[model samples]
Target chain A: MAVYHPDGPLILRLRAGDVDALGELYKRYKTSIYRTALAITRDQGAAEDILQESFLRLFTHAHRIRPDVPLHPWLYRVAVNLSYKWLRKQQKQQKATSDGVLEGLAASFHFLPEQWIERREAQEAIREAITQLPLGHRVVVVLFYLEELSLKEIAEILRIPEGTVKSRLHYARRFLRDTLEGRVPVGEIVYEFT
Target chain B: MSSRDLSSFDPLDRMVKEALQARFAGAEPSPRVWRRIRREAVRQGGRHRSRGIGDWAWFLLMARPTAPLVGRDEFPLGRFGLGMFLFPDAATLMTLRFGW
Candidate 1:
């Protein structure tokens, strides 16, 4: 039985040289791709660059893409590859930029100043712990938790075996738990996601 | 952290999810990204189209018969006319010479 893929038609249109179809597809997945890049790279400029490059590749390689399959996974794969390249190039400089961004984000007060400060502090710690993780483990953590992708989806996106993904996630979770155990009061840290 | 343990990490999973969401709640790419993509895509499409047209134009020029640059009576290099025999047309001769 054939599954109905919404992006199939968009892919066809794009392959037929319809720029409007590309725009529609971009609008559909831009946020997901952008967020994925941002989470992995931890740099807004690099993330934006990855997002643009990913879609441009899609446009260039439209004819080679299978229209029968969903497109987001391909976009995720491209974004991840681009993020890996960026990480390789900016390895030494990443920590300083990410920490500054985290500090800036923690300083902004959203609601009650007291509660916001404490929660932001905890979040900052968690994020710092995430950034400390090895690159492969960090990618898994971001795709699993931030992107909310399943193990299978992550495996396909990363082009690694499911066992590797599971191992990376396990180690990442343990590291985060160990790093934030005594420092953050996990029970008191309450955050609402909009 | 055992490699075989693949079950959900429970409260830790909850914390990680919430923390990530809270941290990047309003994060978004700037509108300029799409603009730049569209511009580059259009430019690339134009390049491909022009290249295709140029290739077709070259094919037609090479394929179409042309009047000889000089009549057989005026043909020079009598025995060494291999270049003229092979090219036969002024367009092909000029193309080979100037690499247009």
Candidate 2:
């Protein structure tokens, strides 16, 4: 009897130039990948672009990928790297924009609501808090809570030490807690998606 | 608050998880993304074929022969009883004869 290996058949078919296998892999992981990109970049268009680029990289580099390993972390690594690249580009462009200057000034001020309200409102508040995190912390939080990847997996994806991942997670959680408890008021959360 | 203070609030983790779930619960990539993926796959397939050995083989087969090795005055010996003719090279003639 042939033993079953998860992701093995799809990867094998992908290596053999089967487009259907690529589509299957995409269908399985696109949501997670898209969410990760969306969480990190906070831009729908950028997330979509990262989603496509990640899979295209997989298609082009399928031969080089080890069939013995799970493909998820590798895909995450590609998405994260692309997200960082996009962030860096935005940072550079923001330096030249007057609106970016005004946004920077607004970020320095803390704006807080008088009292917390409904569950839906609280959820939106938490989402805003996440978006307020710096890119490094935001990514770790997204990977940990949103994607539910282990510290080791996230470390491998980010090419960081496990200890570093732990530290980043700790910092991210603290930042979110502060925001949630009204100790910190991060102004005007930008909702990229309607 | 410090990291330890945050760690003590375990419920925050649950809250964050719930918020993330709620925020992206119904999120789906646009159909255009799949269309783009299919298009890119087709383009990559074309690139793979162009870089393949078969493409090189086809190119070599269709290549116009350099100035014929046999000139008007030269009667090259035909080993297989085939009539002497303007042949490019032994390899080309052999390839044609044996369908190599």
TM-score of each: 0.68, 0.69
lDDT of 2 by residue, A56-131 (tens): 8888888887777788999999999999999889878977765464355335424545454467767777777777
* Span of ten consecutive residues with least summed lDDT in model 1 chain B: B46-55
Steric overlap count per candidate:
0, 0
DockQ of each: 0.17, 0.15
Estimate, for each residue in A1-194, the C-alpha lDDT of model 1 and write its tens digit: 24269898878767777667788899999998998889888899999999999999999899888887888889999999999999977855756567464345434422223442376676876787787788999888888877778888888988998888887877787777776665665443222111
Which ranges of candidate 2 are over 4 A from the true structure? A1-4, A99-109, A183-194, B1-9, B46-100
Which residue pairs in model 1 clash with each other? none
Best by DockQ: 1
lDDT of 2 by residue, B1-100 (tens): 2122234235677677778877775577897987798689878881222222332554544444445854444433332223212233545657789884
Off by over 4 Å in 1: A1-3, A92-117, A186-194, B1-9, B46-100
